[model samples]
Target: MNSTNNRIVQTWIDDQLDLYNLAKQLGDTVWQEQIVQTLYNKEQHTQKRMQQDLWRVFDSINRKMLELFGQLKESSNSYEVRVLREQVWELKLQRIEIVKKINK
Candidate 1:
């Protein structure tokens, strides 16, 4: 995964903790919104493989989100359910951000 993306902006998907069970693998500690601005750009001109990698990460996040949605529906109203809903929303935002960045 080492590339210009790592050296300059340091936006390694591994570093996003919200991606822990969502991504296939996870490490490091970056806030969900604290990632670099380049990762938010719609046409950053990254390598084709980089875009593919982001898609893979996005897909993984989507899978986790689907599971969360199922649990949200299956459970009754409560503080725990509210927490799960919040998590689902965060994952939704993460997925959208990934989409915006990978159009290059």
Candidate 2:
């Protein structure tokens, strides 16, 4: 990503991270680039690992979203449909973040 796109991704991730804090659950990943704080070769390795993890998480989220999609199509209950829609939306956002932040 370019600097502008990268900044947008970082800001979105930070915003999501803050939401987890309010929910009292902070298991979200926090990966950011810093020149001085990182060791020369180690920084590249760490970024690769983080990107791999994000890919795995993205796959899991994709599976869940597809499962929900089927249920969403078949559901007749308005409330259940609403809940499913929200879940799918949240997963979609996460997927977007992963795609943007991951090494391409």
Candidate 3:
């Protein structure tokens, strides 16, 4: 791959890594446990649905990252690599927006 495409893919990988770390930290927060318990008691149905939705988003993001990795591994031309890199960049931006909405 060309240098530019390599750099773009590297940035996308870094962003994904950052997100994985963020999710880990958020999951480990003490307040999260309290929130979960409260929601479980007061709004079990809504809480379960919300959790399912969150898991769906998390799984989708992971799948997309793996797909990007596969594309990077199989890319045979600079053009293909650049296209894959752009897709990853767009995915990263969308993931950030999803996180913002979830946090809100």
Candidate 4:
């Protein structure tokens, strides 16, 4: 992923963590039903956004893989192939993390 996307994902992860922590803290408080419901709605919205982001990442990775495969087919450069393989591995790892976060 590019630096901008990386930053955005990291920021989102941080925000989710903060929200989770807030929910835990509020669990002991005597908040009204409306306040709790609002927080729940916000959490749901965030979750949907995260899922969309993950799908976008997956789509980007798919396109990159396709491009790399085409390049590899056209050239016999071992170094370039190795680099592309490494990038695919990185993308797979990122996908795994995104899946885990979404499951949470």
Candidate 5:
């Protein structure tokens, strides 16, 4: 796996931890408002972090793909970068299914 994939996987795992912590905190009454506020803050932070990570990964991938194209010395029309962008989407779907199963 590439560094970008590694980071995305790691971040997804870390987000699971954050989700657990937020859920636990939300169960407290006295700190309910505080917990909500904290969750909101963390949610925003997580979103931004995830977005930045994705941009970095995609940019790096694009650069590497261009480099590969050049390395092959194949005509531009002959070379097509077959990027498997669906892997991440599939992983996300699997994660959601697992979470739903656990909830049930």
Candidate 6:
């Protein structure tokens, strides 16, 4: 990957990581449980919508990584591939954590 693309991807991953941290904080907050119980149906609907949005982002990221992987196979940009792999891993972890929070 060119330096510009690398910077862009890194910035994106950083933003996603920040988002995950905020989400974790929100999930752990005391108000979340009360809100969950008080607004069960609404909470479920919101969670479903959020999950769908996350899935769409996840799918797009996966497709981009796959395309990058093809490029990597043709070249030898191990560092870029590693960075992309880490991003994918972190994104997947965030998705799992969000799902767990919603299910709880």
The positional error of residue 27 in candidate 1, measured at the CA in angstroms, is: 41
Error of 3 at 79 (Å): 0.8
The CA lDDT at 61 in model 6 is: 58
Off by over 4 Å in 2: 1-40
Q: Write the per-residue lDDT of candidate 2 for residues 1-104, one digit (tens) a residue.
A: 55654654565555644554654453333422232223334435456656776788899999999999999999999999999999999999989988987846
> Which ranges of candidate 3 are over 4 A from the true structure?
1-48
Angstrom error of the Cα, residue 85, model 2: value is: 0.8
User: Which lDDT tens digits does candidate 6 get at residues 60-99?
Assistant: 6567667756765775677886876676677567667645
lDDT of each: 0.67, 0.70, 0.66, 0.68, 0.54, 0.58
Query: Judged by lDDT, which candidate is best?
Result: 2
Candidate topping TM-score? 2
Tens digit of lDDT per residue, candidate 3, span 12-99?
Answer: 5555456556756878555555544544454444444455665678669869988997989998999999998888888788778667
Candidate with more favorable, higher lDDT: 2 or 3: 2
Give the alpha carbon lDDT tens digit for every residue of 1-104 in model 1.
34556643344443433354343344333433344443454135345547777889899998999899899889897987999999998998998888988874
Model 2 poorest ten-residue lDDT run? 28-37
Winner by lDDT between candidate 3 and candidate 1: 1
Query: Higher-lDDT candidate among 3 and 5?
Result: 3
Model 2: residue 96 alpha-carbon error in angstroms: 1.2
Per-residue error for 57 in candidate 5, Å, reads 0.3
C-alpha root-mean-square deviation, each candidate: 15.0, 12.0, 16.9, 9.1, 11.5, 14.7
When 2 and 3 are scored with TM-score, the better candidate is 2
Q: In model 3, how large is the Cα lDDT of residue 102?
A: 56
Colliding residue pairs in candidate 6: none
TM-score of each: 0.56, 0.57, 0.49, 0.54, 0.35, 0.39
